[model samples]
Each structure stands twice: as C-alpha cells, then as structure tokens.
Target: MSSTLSRVRAAYARVEAVGRPEIWIDLRPREETEAEARAIDERVAAGERLPLAGRLFAAKGNIDVRGLPTTAGCPAYAYEPAADAPVVARLRAAGALVLGTTNLDQFATGLVGTRSPYGAVRNAIDPSRISGGSSSGSAVAVALGIVDFALGTDTAGSGRIPAAFNGIVGLKPTRGLVPTAGVVPACASIDCVTVFARTLAEAEQALSHAAAGPEHALPPLPRRRPGPWRVAVPPIGQLGELDEGWVAAYEAAVARLTAAGASVRTLDLTPFTEAAAMLYEGAFVAERYTAVGPFVDKLISSGGEGLDPTVAGIITRARDIPAHRLFADQERLADLRARALAELSDADALLLPTAPGHPTLAEVAADPLGANARLGRFTNSTNLFDLAAVAVPAGEVNGLPFGVMLIGPAFTDERLAAIARSLEPRVRLAVLGAHLTGQPLNSQLLAQGAVLDGTTTTAPAYRFHALRTDPPKPGLVHVGGGGAAIETEVWTLPAEGLGRLLASLPRPMTLGTVELADGTTAAGFLCEPDALTDAEDITRYGGWRAFLAGAEDSAPSGVRGTARSAPTHPHAPLGDHPTDE
Candidate 1:
C-alpha cells in the first residue's frame, strides 16, 4: 500500500478504536473510507494532482455530504441530500475524503455541545469538560486526529468556540465567501461555513478551496505582509468573569504578541460586547426563528419535539418579537458595526479571547443558557459586523485549552490566515513567469493571498525558456550542469494556497522544490522536459521581464512566439477562478 493509504488506514483504525459515539452522528463505513483511499492512491499514481489527497475530513451534521442524512443535530429533521454541500464538494474535488458526519447542538442554537440528543461530545483532552458546539463533533474529530480538518457552520460562536475548547484552529471566513447552498442555516443571512483543523495551514487549505464559490464577486484582498502589526485588545476592566487561570493565559498571550513585535493596545470593547448581546437579547433572534421555524412548528404540532428545551425555548421566543423590533435591531446593529469598525480602524486585527471560560459538562448542564452566553461574549459580534476571524490555541489553562481569535474586516480572510500562520508554522514558495508583480496573471498570486518576501536568483542550476503559448509564459528546467542563476521571487503563501496554485497549472508546468542562490530550498515553478522542445531559450535574458522587454523592443525572433490579445478583466475583484470569471 502507498504511504498515504497506510497513514489513512491507521487513522481510521484509531478512530474506530476510540468508540466515541457522541463525536459522530453518522460515520461513513470503514470499508467505504478505505475504498476511497485506495481510489485516491490510484488517481495519484495515474498522475492526477489532488490538493488534499488522502486527507481525512468530516462535516457538521448540518452540512450535506452525499449518502449521509443531514440532521443539523435534530434527527427528526434529517434529510438526505442528493449531493454534498458546495463546501464539502469543493473539499472532495481537492482530494479530501469524508470520514463521517459529526454531531452538533440541535438546530445549531446552542454553544454547549450537551444540547444535542446524540449526547454531548466529550472534550478531546478532558472528557469531563463540555465539547464546545454546535460544531462540537467536528472540532472533536479534528482534535482527536481522526480527521485532518472538518467543516462547520458559524453563526454566533458555533464554529469558533468549539475550536477554542478543542485546542485547534477555527477559521470562519468572511460571510458569503463560501456558498451556503447545501447547509442547514442557523441564521441564513449571517451563517458562515467554517473550518476546524489541527493547524492553521490545514484550516486554510480547506478554506482556500471552500471560500470562493463559482459566483463570488468580491475582489481578492491584498496579501497581509508580515511585520509588527497593530493588535487591539480589550481593556482589563471590560474582561468579564474569566477565572484567574484563563486571565493569566490571556495576558501571557498578549505579552508574547508584544514580544513578537506586535503593537498591542487596549481598546474600548463596549461596542463589541453590546453587539454580541444583540444576537440573543435583541431582535436578531428572529433570524434563527426564520431558518428552521417551520420545521420546529411541525415537530411541536406533531407532538414530536426533538430539540433541547433550551434550544427550543430560544427559537420559540422569536415568535413574540415584532417585525419593527427586528428592523430596529438591524439599524442598531448597523450603528454598532460602525462603532466596532472604528475601534479596529487603527489596528490590523482585533485580538480577543475566543471564550471567557471553558465550562464542564456538569456546569453546562446546570446552566446551559448562561454558560453559552458567556462563551459568545467575544465571538457573536463578528458575523454581525461581517468581519473575518481565525481562532487559534493560545495555551492551556489548568489542563484545559484556551484560544484567541484575530478579527479583521470583510474579505480579509487571507489576511487573517497570514496572521494566524505567523503565530504558528508556515511554508515559503518561489514563483516566476505569470505570477510576478505587474504581470497579466499576477492577480492569481494575490488571489491565493501570498505576500512577496523578496527577490533572489536560483543557485545556477536551471535554464529558462519562453514557452510557445498564447500568453507567452516562461518555464524553468533544472539542468545538472552548465546552468545559470535565474531571477525569481519568493513568497510566503499558505501551504493550501500553494496546493491550489499547483492544481490549477496547465500541462507542461509543475511545482517542484528549487534551490535558491542562498542555499535554501523552496517550492518553485518548473517545466516538463518535453516542453523545452520548440521553445525559445531565454537564459541569456536573465528573467521573464527582460525577455518580454526584448521581445517588445524587437521583432519576433525564431521560437519567440508573439503574445496573444489580452482579455478584459470585468471582475478583477472576483479573482482568477475560471468558473467565476
């Protein structure tokens, strides 16, 4: 068996060995999972490039994965979708295999995992603690190493809190970036599909595939360059009810950020906290009522109540809220969004604890609503303001995990990923040809959210050629000897972004590790040996730009193909995805 298939088999074996029924509402059969692994190996052997090849993944019960019933954590409300949710389909297309459908809080109404009838998902590290939810099962699966990453829905703190509790990475992208087509909505308009993984790169790898739908219209945000960034923190007086352990952990995290050159400053958090209150205490609760209200009403009428009392109570109350009150709440939310954005104006991101505390299952059982509300103190405001956020493990407090989230403006998903990676580990890559700055295809780099680190030359081991194509691309072929240093640009892109870029490249080009002049190795663009046939040797020109300049100044010489007509960019903001453009 191939190494990837072997690794997958071991992972599945470990998951089976755990016997944690609460962690999954419905799991794909072990035989089926292994069969898919074998298929992936076959495809890889056949030379197909799958970005997430052999990676195991799970989906929240709310997200439709073909052959599984989507219950949204309420079994009575289950429905079998004909196909996977758009997000899940994207992950599968990129080579990830689904292991199962995980449990969640019923109707995605509660933050504590105990609200589910399937049973509270136990904390991965400490079984006595509440596994944060409604994406509880998804987070736990990732935390337990059963899956590389999982999909969750985030409205309120459904996505972030679970990651915080599980000591994993939670990436809730900007609202509307990932299409919600096949997801059971919590608050349809505000719900965002989220990613949970053991590392930022894993979450980002899934996000890069899932974020942009075929019809996304927003322009790609500029890459966030690494440096001493402005990070906003809430004033000490505003921190509520956090135990000493959590407070110490939070403070130490800030110190680390400061030591790492971040300009950590205190900002008034009143607006943010107030906005969070609007999610439950204000009229915005009506949106939740609208999402599953009919089904809820049917269950009640049929005398088949599957929802937890707390969840049912929360959604039922929305019926009493007047329409004008919801409108008034929306207007109030607009004002709060402005105020919150103002506080973040001078900062690249707002840094806040993902949750004030991690409650035990018994504690949650005693006071579900109160404990859940406390968890949202730092998270509920994000979606209301249409911002992006990444929750990462800060450190453990008294054996329990604590996490912090970095919030940025809408479309700043890539930027948040950058900041998240800076706090963890990352990969660096090299690029030439179309991705160079000011080139026709340079937007692809920005689309992938890569930052230019610096320019350097290869270690005198490659020959450059101008490929005979409509766009007049360049190709670098590594030669054993008699090669010259080739000019190239190095970028620190997320590993997932690099995968997407690799998958999108046309035939005759590939991504391979290249040696830089500084004696360092990085993933860089390369060409198939056969591509050099009938191609113009541009090694003497030094780089793509120089060759292009020479071509522009002089007549088309032998093998120097003329450039084709440039296409108009109507959706320059939407990025280079052929499906969208």
Candidate 2:
C-alpha cells in the first residue's frame, strides 16, 4: 500500500477497534478507494504532485458530492446531483478523494447532533456527551481521525460548536469566500461552508485549497503584512451564562495571547448580540423557508414521511412570517450591523467563547429550540454582520472541552488564520511548570502552539515564584547559588519563530535565559524586579495553578453574573440574513 493508504487503513483499524460506527453515514466504496490510490501511484510515477495528493476527506451530506445523495439529514429530501459543490470540486481537483457524505442535524436546524434520523454523532472524547451539530458528523469524523479533514456548513453554530465539542479546529471562512452554489441551504444568505481538522495547519491547508477562485480562473488571494494584532474580547458584562470553569478557560486563553505579545482589550458586544438574535427569531427564518420551501411543502403534504420532526417544525414556523415583518427586520439589522462595524472598526479581530455552555443530548432533546439557541449565542451574528470566524479548542472544563473563537471582518479570513496560528499554545512550555493540564495559563500556552512534550520536573536546584498583578502572572526568577531544585516542564517553539515572537514583547515582561534544576537554560518569561514592587508574591502557592486555585476559592458567586445574559432575541437589533436578487 502507498503511505497515504497505509495511514488511512491504520486509522480505519483504530476506528473499528473503538466500535464507533455512527461517526460516518457512509464511506467511499473499496473500489473507489483503490482507484484513488492507483491514481496517486501513477502521479508519483509521472513525477506530478498536488497539495492534497492522496488525502481522504468527507463532506457533510448537505453539500453535494456528485454521486452521493445530498440528504441534509432527511432521506425524503435527498437528491442526486450531477456535479460537486464548487468547494468540493476544488478539493478533488487538488487530489483529495471524497470519502462520502456524512450525517447532520435534520435540515440543519438544530445544534445538538441527535436531531436526525441517522444516529447521534458521539463526542470523540466522551460518547455520552454531545457532538455538537449540525456539523456534528463532520467534526466527529476529523476528531476520530477518520479523515484528515472534512467539509461542513455553518449557518448558526453548526460549524463552530461541533468543533468546540470535539476538540478540533473549525474554520468558518468569510461569507462568500467559498461559494455555496451546490449546498443545501439552511439560511441561504447566511450559509457558510466550513472545514474541520485535527490541527490549525490541517484546517488552513483545507481552506487554502477551497477558498475563492473564478469559475474559469484561479487567482491568488491577496496577501497582507503582519504586525501586532489588536484582538477584542467581549466585556465581562457581555458574557452570558458562562460557568466558573469556562470563565477560567477564557481568562487563561487571554493570558496566552498577552504572553504571546498580542494586544488584548475588551469591547462592548450589545450591537453584535442584537444582530445575532435576528437570525432565528427575526425574519431570517423566512430565508430558510425560501431555500427549501417546496421540498418541505412536498414532504409535509406526503405526511412528513422522511422529515425529522424537529426540522419539520422549524421550517413550518416560517409559513407564518409576513413580508412586512421581514422588511422591518431588514431595517433593524442594517442599523445593528452599522453599530457593530463601528465598534470593531479598529480591531484586527474579536474573540469570544465558542458557546456559553455545552448541553447534553437529553437537554437538547427536552428543549431543542432553547438548547440550540443557546449554542448559537455568540455565533449567529457573524454572517448576519458579514464576518469570518475560527473556532480553536482551548482546553477542557470538568472533562468537557471548552473553545474560544476568533472572528474578523469579511475577507480578512487569511489574516485571521495567521493570527490564530500565532496564538495557539505550545506543548513544551506546559511540562516545565508542574502546570500540566487543567492549570491556569496552560490553555494560553496551548493557544500559542505548545504541544505537551511529556512531563518532567526541575533539576536539583531552582525556585518558583508567582508575581502578583491584577490578573496575577507567574515568574521563575532564579535565586542563584544555593536555590533548591524546582519541579517544572518544558515546551518547544520554532527557534526563529520564537525569536520573532519574543521581539514583540511589551513592557514589564521580558524573555530571558532561565536556569532549570537540571542546570539547563531555556527561554521563559521574566518580570523586571522593579515591576514587581506593587505585585503580590504567591510563590508559596507554587506555580500559576496553585495561585489560580486560591483565586477560585475566593471568587464571588456574583462574578459570573457580571456577564450579560444572551438576549432572548439576539438578532432583534439586526433584522435578518440579507437576501439578494
């Protein structure tokens, strides 16, 4: 077997060993797989190469892939298209083999993966929990290593929530970045084709292959210069219904960015939240109806034989919306979009929780609409206001994964990706501090591209100290000569890349050579002694984690109340997803 096939077969073996068969609706037939392998073999013989040569991928059933039936999770609505969606065609042209269509929430109306006739897509980490939807299968497929990457569609939180739940990267490109010419639409004007992958590099690789090109010509995307990116976080008052665990996760995520030398600040999200509400509660429901009205009507007329009840209910709600109401919603949305644009006019990107909280399958089924609405709390407004987003898995909270999303204005997709690439944490750093997993600032390291280099402790002589600042920062200043051995871990970053990163540091913090207990020197963060005069020293608490533990103990119950609850009608201020002639 070729190396790619060997790898794929190995991955498949693991999948079979796990006995998680529902992760895919179907797989490419053996003949098709062998044919693709042979084609790659021939290319190698001919000395021709492609970016995605021999890579395997799956598409959400809502996106047409020629011979696969486009089900949108409703067999009654299935259609066999003669051609692939533009995005799918591009990937295949780049030498990616389409594995087959995967499952989704029926009609892409729900966020919980179980709202389909097909079996629920279980979380890769914990099957009892949800694999978020309607991109559920897509995320699960990648998380389980079934495919290198997969194609999904994001209408509200379909693309992002699933990625967050499954601990993968979901890149929801700017609206129109990947044409939606052949995908089954949920909200046509707001629909976005998304990619799910195990790593940021893999996700970007998929994006680069699928991004915009003309029907007849492919022009390179415009390149831009990089600098210290200004990232905006929603003011604490705007964070709705987040638990202590998620709050810690977000704080840690921010510290990572700050440590990476990026400027992080808070901004009001009233305008953005208002715009998000209109997506479902406002007239956008009409757009969903418009896209599949005939199919839905026929399905209903035929006694709802193949339609998922939840989807049928959601689409049927559209029948009552009046044209005048839609116009009013449009006017409202225009004003909200303007305000949101004004708020974000200066920042390079905005960051927020991928979802306020993750709900279980039972919670979703018991109150499908409310549960799904909550998942889209921060996501619905993106396309309505014309923005691109990348959801990066930050870390876990109480064994559940927590994610943070970075968003940018439309067409700034590439820049946003670059920024995310820089912020992802490294593994080497996590091992050095006894911080390990679930520690404060650990997520920050991960955000910066730190992968775990396995665990180890400090050498025979070293001391650790926690410097007090408003948010509290960590310092490892060596006391020299007779200092005791400290327990710590090590993380690695590309040398040239680390230098470029260190050069961007701001005041009060500096990168310096530090002596480990083992008498080895490594680059680590240090605070100028003068800067610590007013800072509280918590070295007795050991590393950042111990300090954070105490902070959590003293944290007030009302601190979480500080975040604004997502308004019931998030899109109320913004009107709806815009429809064009």
The estimated TM-scores of all candidates read 0.74, 0.73
**Which segments of model 1 are wrong by more than 4 Å?**
212-214, 217-227, 425-581
Instruction: Report how far residue 508 has shifted in candidate 2, in Å.
Output: 46
lDDT of 1 by residue, 49-87 (tens): 675676778999999999999999898999989999988
CA lDDT, every prediction? 0.80, 0.72
Worst 10 residues of 2 by lDDT: 572-581
Model 1, position 137: C-alpha lDDT score: 95
Worst window of 10 by summed lDDT in candidate 1: 572-581
lDDT of 2 by residue, 476-547 (tens): 556666544433456664343254335545455667665554456666666566675655555454445545
**Which lDDT value does model 2 have at 330?**
93
Over the full model, what C-alpha lDDT does candidate 1 score relative to the true structure? 0.80
- TM-score quality measure for candidate 1: 0.74
